[model samples]
Target chain A: MKELSLNILDIVENSTKAKAELVEIEIIEDKTTLTVRITDDGSGMSEETLLSVTDPFYTTRTTRKVGMGIPLFRLAAEQTGGSLTITSHHIDDYPEEHGTVVNASFDKSHIDFTPLGDIVSTITTLIQGHPDVDFKFTHTVDDSSVSLDTRELREVLDDIPLDNFEVLLWIKDNLIEQYNKIKYK
Target chain B: MKSLAELQAIKERMKNKIVLREGTGDIRVVVGMATCGIAAGARPVLAAFVEEVSNAGLNDKVTVSQTGCVGYCQLEPIVEIYEAGKDKVTYIHMTADKAKEVVEKHLKGGKIVAEYTVTDDN
Candidate 1:
């Protein structure tokens, strides 16, 4: 992907496809490194699926022969002197805690690291696209952090759809304000 | 920073407008966003539809959304449009510019841009 947020968008689509009810995305950026972690409560992958997920040619989709999300993300991380890891627990083996967690980190100052694109759009699009799924996003830069919980927003929204243009615009502005405070502080 | 109060005002104004559109079967625009699709630049295409739909104030009549792979990796960044009582139109190898044309020509002008469709190549 051209931007880190796009990568996040790509990965979370898998979580939604896995039938996850709740997906959590976290971004932590410090002076040295930038880390992204996405955790999902979905039908976790099998041990075999998890092992080969990083392979660009491996995909569970019957529609296509190649899955490039993980592999490309892994490459992006590795090229920046960082790493990517995926941990999953199959539902058959762990009924109570069945899901997948992907952790990718990149050196903060790496020349090849892509900029964090418009994350507010990325997040709001996902929330609007999958209204039934709850998403929690946490972004931390240095010592400050901002978090958004769609479950809580849903409680406040009540009947108004999240995809409403005005509501989505508000969300984008709010996220930008919060991220700016942390980023510029 | 925008306030929630603004959203509340919009919600109040939109409530009835939105309620009337329910079950009316609006036009649906689905962008492919699978691994291959994203790699082929589907994100901007999706964003363009959302933006153009809203900009044209056609949200009530048109809904923009996404889908996973559509079995055509070679035709990544594909877009499918469904209108009530009409067959689905699949556009292949789409870009944001092409998406804009689609929104303007097909969605707004009621004329499908035949040249950009998969059937055009065939």
Candidate 2:
């Protein structure tokens, strides 16, 4: 993807596709580096699949073999001399620990570093499409930060779905408001 | 920051109205969002559909959601619209602007935007 947030949106979909009940996304940025971690409580991949995820040709999908999500993410980081790592435990193996964690880091000092685009749109879009799944997102730049956890909202919403048009708009506005607070901090 | 307590206010407002999760919309708009689709700019298109659907007050009559690749990476950024009686209309290589037109013309007017539809079913 052209921007980091679009990649974030794409990777989170993989978690939801695995039927993840909860997805946690964390982005940490310091002077010269940026890191993103996405953890999902979904049906994780086997060790065999994990080894080949960085390979664009490796995919579990039956419809056409190539899966570019992970590969592209890896490329985005590595192209800046950074790194991507994935850890997964399939349900058939560790029933309790069956989930996936994808962590990628980027060298912000690099001239080719990809820009972080409209992340608020990415998070809200994911929620609108899959409101049933809970998402916990935190972004930290330097010491200032912003975070949101849908599980907390669920407690108040009760029966109201996150996909509700009003709720989704509120979420988008809320996220933008939070980001604005930290934008100059 | 917009606090959770504010959302509580919305919840209160929503409680007074009937929640309509059941008996879902008659029309469904599904956007393909796989790697190929995202690469081809499906995000803006999807966003436009959501905003326009809400703006048109069709939230009760139409549902917007996403799906994995339809096995047609060549036709990335595809959108499938399903209405009660009509056959599914697959629009390929769509954009945010095209999405708005589809919403106004096809969805609101009850006529498929044939120019945007995929020609070959194969």
Candidate 3:
């Protein structure tokens, strides 16, 4: 992916495929480091699956020979002298608390650091595609932060779908307004 | 800043429209959105479809969504359109611009853009 936002989208897609009902995406930008942490309450992976998740050749899919989501994400972070870490608890093992967490940290000073492009679009796209699923998104840069939680919107909208075009547009505009507040980073 | 008050107003406006759409059939526009598709630029394609469908005021009659890997890596960024009681039309290797045309032609005009559809080779 050309942008880190695209990688975020790809990883979250994996979460949804695993039957996650809630996904939380957090981006924290510090002085010289950038970190993206995605947590999902999905059917987590097995030990075998978790071990080979970063391997481009290993995939649960029988149709194709490779799965590139985690692998590419790892590459993107490593290219900037950063690292990617994933932890999961399968339902078979931890039935009460089964989910996955993906944390990738990057050295923003590195020349190869990828930019975060059009996160507003990513957020809106995720909501538009999966209106039933809930998402919590937060981006923190310096002293400024922006956040949105669908649960709140759900409380407000009793019968309306989250994918309603006007609602999605409102979300996009809200995100834009929030990003505009993060003037420094 | 976006406030809940504005959303409340939008909800009020949408109430009548929602009731009118209750019993009618809705078309489905599904886009491939796996790693291959994202790498091939399906994000923009999906976004374009959403915006175009909204702009054309077809939200009541159409729904746009995404799918996992289509298993055809070479045909990344594929899009499929399904109408009730009809065969699904699969469009391959789509871009943002192509998504708009597909919306206008196949979606709105009730005519398929055959050239963009997959054939035996594709």
Q: DockQ winner among the candidates?
A: 3
**Global Cα lDDT for candidate 1:** 0.86
Task: State which docking tier applies to candidate 2.
Answer: medium
Distance (Å) between predicted and true CA of B13, model 3?
1.5
User: What tens digits encode model 1's per-residue C-alpha lDDT throughout A1-185?
Assistant: 78888889999999999999999999998888899999999999999989899988898888657888899899989999999999999999999999999999999798888777778778987976887889999998888898888777666677887777767777878888887776643
Give the number of the best model, judged by lDDT. 3
What lDDT score is found at residue B71 in candidate 3?
Answer: 91
lDDT of 3 at B116: 92
Candidate 2: list runs displaced more than 4 Å. Answer: B19-24
RMSD in order of candidates: 2.1, 1.7, 1.4
Candidates sorted by DockQ, best first: 3, 2, 1
Worst 10 residues of 1 chain A by lDDT: A176-185
Each model's DockQ? 0.58, 0.71, 0.77
> Per-candidate TM vs. native?
0.92, 0.96, 0.96
Task: List candidate 3 stretches off by more than 4 Å.
Answer: none
Candidate 1 docking classification: medium
Give a tens-digit lDDT track for model 2, residues A1-185: 88999999999999999999999999999999999999999999988989988889998778889999999999999999999999998999989989999999999999889888988889988998899999999999899888889998899999888987788888988888888887733
Winner of 2 and 3 under DockQ:
3
Backbone clashes (count) for model 1:
0
> Clashing residue pairs, candidate 2?
none
